[model samples]
Target: MLGSLLLLWAGLLLLYFLWKTRRPKNFPPGPQPFPIFGNLLQLNLKNPMKDFEKLSKRYGKVYSVYFGGKPVVLLHGLQSVKEALMTRGVEFGGRPQGLLVNDINENKGVIIVNYGPSWKEQRRFAMSTLRNFGLGKLSMEERILEETSHLNSYIDKSAGQCLDPQTLFHNALSNVICAIMFGSHYNYEDQSFQSLIRMITENTKIINGPWGMLYDTIPLIRSLPLPFQKIFENRDKVKAFFQAKVTEHKETRVPGKPRDMIDCYLNEIDKRGNDGSSFDDGFMMVFLMDLFVAGTDTSSTTLRVGLLQLMMHPDVQARCQQEIDTVLGERKQVCYEDRHRMPYVQAVIHEVQRYGSVVPLSVFHATTQDTQVLGYSIPKGTMIIPNLSSVLYEEGQWKFPHDFNPSNFLNKEGEFVKPEAFVPFSLGPRMCLGEALARMELFLFFVTLLRRFQFHWPQDGGEPDLTPHFGIIQGPRPYRLGVRLRGRQSG
Candidate 1:
């Protein structure tokens, strides 16, 4: 009787394996699957870019790999990614849902939610709110300059020493978004704000790691007492922080007088009440959290990586200072208009983004309708990973794709020329909504720091590692740099 049962179990497993691997005749080519795991065992688990590159070499530009039982198409090179995301955006703009999104956001917010009427409204409203809040005006520039002043003051008192810049970057960047979203900025020493920062930092680390991928791939096991359960718990704590803020705004909000983003959203909600949409308190909380994280992590990581890049290449740093001194002429503050006169600085900024490649994989996009790419059929609901590293480092798209050279964005005339492959903010309808604000922050903060201080390697002669920490953003590991006040040359 026992031997008969064992044979029956083995027979059932074989049938399931065969069913999972069976696909339509015209599906993209990929590695053979052993069983329910598919080619998941072949992946690197930590850095999937290397694995995807290997698969691309074996299969082709458009190929499929299964995570658990689900099929995911990995698009390699610039043309393949553009064909799917830019050309066929409406068909491929939807987001795939699983434990990572549904369990965390309840299938809410602008980035992770499926693209449709609700997503369109929320995204459009959010972008417009940012624009009305002075994303292009001197007011937005002033917000960044205010944070720069605080950052400079913090660094000034800790002068002549090596310092880890992680929290400093977070505090400054988060404050800018807070002032925009909540109508005020927190003090650097605020305990509650510090706790929120900790949650956001922890979230980025966990959400991009292998465990998060596993949870999404095999959500059935999520119900058990497992380590991955901490992600949901941490998510709740972060949500509660924003939820309380929403309540406070509800009680104190006035009619016809919007103070900040929260107020504007509240007014909109009241206007559209009982219309049966996703415009409510819960979605609003998730939206605010989305803005806070998107605004904070990538920009802060870029600024952090920017300092390390400059430290490694002092000549580039010196040239940037030279341009600033020659153009601005002892100006205490640099504005958005100043970028028009500073090409070298702009080139350096673009190069840092290309080299850093923070958010190496564009956010996962799903097909809302059946789509065909490169003469191959991509069924509706297929998950697409547009390998951004392939685009940023594509062979013919860049002059020096592998090096940390600023000439990648410069012409013979020393003017900044943006390459077609420079999609650091991604592209198409699902492109980064914070492009205007992020560009403003990057320029203002980069100029402000370089104008005031000179960053160098530690006095102990230990070299800082440029290898990324590989989270949501490919941030540098927590490292220290020697900071010194520069002369009035760049003032």
Candidate 2:
């Protein structure tokens, strides 16, 4: 009886293997699959982009890879990414409902939702809300300048000592986001605010590890009463914090004038008056959470990477200082409009983003409908992942894809030249909603620090490790840097 059962199991396994090899005629070429698992076992999971780059070398710019049982078409190179994300934008606008994002936001927020009337309504409302809160106006500039001032003072208080700038930079970035979303800011010592920040950091760290992949493959694991429970508990903590803030905003809402995103959302809820569409309290809470997560981490990590780059390459740092000194001599604060005059500084910012490429694969994009790319048929509901790092570091597109070269963004005449492949904020309708705000913050914060202080490697040690600690976002390995006040003779 045992021998007979073993023979039957072997036959079933053979049949499954045979079925896995039979791909549709128009499907893109990829590694062959085995029984049950598909090609998922072959993927690195921890650092999938490295595997993705290797596959691109083998299977050309655009090809398909299977994650668990799902099909994901990976787009590489500048031309392919632009074609899929830009020219044929709407058809490929849906976001996938997977473990990492769905477990957190649950298809409600602007950043990770399917392309539909609901998504359209929420996105439109958000764009309008940001504009109402002085997104690109002098008022908005004042908010950023205020945050920069606070940040500079905090760094200056370090008294030219070496310290890890991560927490300080994170506080400044999170405050800017907080002011935009909540119409208020938290002091550095606020325990509740610090707890929220810790939650954000933990989520980013865990979601990029093996456990995240395990959850993605077998979501039922999240239901088990163990370590997975902590994920939900943490998520609830974040949601509850936002919910409380939303309730506060509702209580303080004025008749017509909106104060921040929460106020604008509350106003919309009042305006809609049981329209029963997308705008609701639940949506508002999720939207606020999305803004908190997306806006804070990416900007903070980029700035951290920028500071490390400056320490590593002091010549680049000196050039940026010279430009800031030349442009804003003795000015109390740097302004957004002054960015154009500081070409080298702008170039360095661009280089930092490109070199870091924080969101290496970007938030995963899915196909809303059946589509074809580069002569391969992408089925409806197929996952579309644009390898953002590939575009930023593509050999033909960048002068030194690996090095921190500001010239990559400069012309022969020494003016800053924006590269077409520079899509750090991504592309198409789903591009980062906080692009303008993030750019303004990075510019003001970076220039402010360079103008007042010089970032140098620690005097007691070897070199500060410049290697990145990749999470959902990539940032530099933790290291301390000396912050010496820049004197007039420096420039």
Q: Which one wins on TM-score?
A: 1
Q: Against the hidden true structure, what lDDT does model 1 obtain?
A: 0.86
* Per-residue accuracy of model 1 over 53-125 as CA lDDT, tens digit each: 8889999889998887888888888888889889998888989877576668888888888999889989999
Provide the TM-score for each candidate, comma-separated: 0.96, 0.95
The sequence of per-residue lDDT tens digits that candidate 2 reaches over residues 244-303 is 988877787786887777777777878889888888877777788888888899999998
Candidate 2's displacement at residue 476, Å, is 1.6
- Please tell me which predicted candidate would have the highest lDDT against the true structure: 1
Per-residue error at 197 for model 1, in Å? 1.2
Model 1 weakest lDDT span, ten residues long: 482-491
